[model samples]
Target: MQFGPFLKKSLPKYLFIIPAFLFVVIFMLYPIFYNIFISFQDVTIMNLKGDKSFIGVENYRQIFQDERFLLSLKNTVIYTVSCIVFQLSIGFLLALFFNQQFPMRNFFRSILLLAWMTPLVITGTLFKWLYDVDYGVLNYLLIQIGLISEPINWLGQQSTALMAIIVTNIWIGIPFNMILLLSALQALPSDVYEAAKIDGASRIQSFFKITLPLMKPATLVVLVLGIIYTFKVFDIILIMTGGGPVNATQVLPFFGYELAFVNFKFSLSGAVATIILVILTVISLIYLYLIRKEESM
Candidate 1:
């Protein structure tokens, strides 16, 4: 085929991608680059529309020095790590259980997805009432079960506020993790398990030697995705605690939001947003690398 003819043949195929390419550039890339630019400028409500001075890295410096930022960072780490660990562990166990032949297995799995399907705002609002110090079913049940003699201020006390949010997030996350893992488990080769059983391998041994090794890729994908989703949590905190109880449940996204809207520190908020972008970018790169490695294997 001549080069001219080949080019003409492929031209139409390439033309079809232009709209999607332009959409990404306009909506996603443009906003990201604009935010990065704003992060380097001294933008505030006073100078938002006027001449904004380019004070490179000053906003980042100020953000680092701010005590609330540091506290929110700490809380974010705690919340994300806690959610991932509990969500993965519980979800894995649930997947394993549901993978077996059992009565009403599909029904139970479908019901569990209600928490994940519900909007985060609604879930947070529902949990807010559930975590209420008084007239909350959770505290009432705890008291009835003799776990505590008093109604614990789950969302009002700083010590328990973050934990309460973590629990709520975990509940929301579990079904997602379970569904992904269950799909992976069901796709696994049954012949391998049969062979392992023929070799007199115990269920635990088969799981450790066969199941875990095969599930590594899916598990890692789920873990990284869980981190990405959990790290950017905002609405839940807004509805449940508003980062209150002395900023106990404050997280990075909410902190950035507060800086921009409440404090009107647009530059600082932009810096915070850039930081989150960088962190998630690194994570995404890791995920891509893992996927490539798995494919190579």
Candidate 2:
């Protein structure tokens, strides 16, 4: 290989990528390395005792053995799955609803995007208030309708605490999915719908045979992106329930926080974070493979 000629040909492209490469190296790669280093050593905010000792796999082993860590893992998995199901389902229904010519369609579309546009912290606080046992809109409405005698402790109860957070996440997530799916629905060929109508295909039948299949790409995109978002969720759980009502809403990110800050176990926290990174990478690859498979067909 002619090194000089290769450099001459590829230098500009490399130059173009230099800024992004530097960014990744400085922000992403550096922090990843730092975390990995922290994972090997026993670290603390104060005395960095046991700094020199190399505790190989001890952190990983400890996290696995800990009941809290195990519960956090299970909760993370359940949270991801439940968030995906609810967001995708509600989003698809909303997409279908808006696909038809409706009054104030543009207004409704803007409102949906507005919800997604609001800051995460703001959303979390609002939801926290809404889930409050003593004074919440949900309980008030339910009471007015004679559905419940007393206000339900939405975030205070172990049974409903996790579910309350999931509901908020779904609300935060649905708008994005709806917008993407709505665009996809609009792009679908009207001729197909017309032909189906002529063939006496019912609305439900046309939706199943034509609409759903065409919306697969949009659905896939939403599902993968939503899963990623929900999996990494921290602020909502922290603000709403503090991963509480006895750790019912404790997902992986919150668990990482609790381990590192609350327990002051940097090594174990880093190990758990690294494990989460591996899982996320695997999930991303699977999603990419499925998307490609669907695209190829």
Highest lDDT model number = 1
Q: Give lDDT for model 1.
A: 0.95
User: Residue-wise lDDT of candidate 1 within 1-297, one digit each (tens)?
Assistant: 699999999999989999999999999999999999999999999999999999989899999999999999999999999999999999999999999998999999999999999999889989988988879999999999999999999999999999999999999999999999999999999999999999999999999999999999999999999999999999999988899999998999999999999999999999999999999999999999988998998
- Of candidate 2, the 10-residue stretch with the lowest lDDT total is 44-53
Q: Which candidate is the best by TM-score?
A: 1
Candidate 2 lDDT over 224-295, as tens digits, reads 788778888898887778889888888889999988899887777899889888888888899899888997
lDDT of 2 at 62: 82
Query: What is residue 184's positional error in candidate 1, in angstroms?
Result: 0.5
lDDT of 1 at 293: 90
**How do the predictions measure up, each by TM-score?**
0.95, 0.90
In order, candidate lDDTs are 0.95, 0.87
Q: What is the lDDT of residue 235 in candidate 1?
A: 90
Clashes of each: 0, 0
Clashing pairs in 1: none
Error of 2 at 253 (Å): 0.6
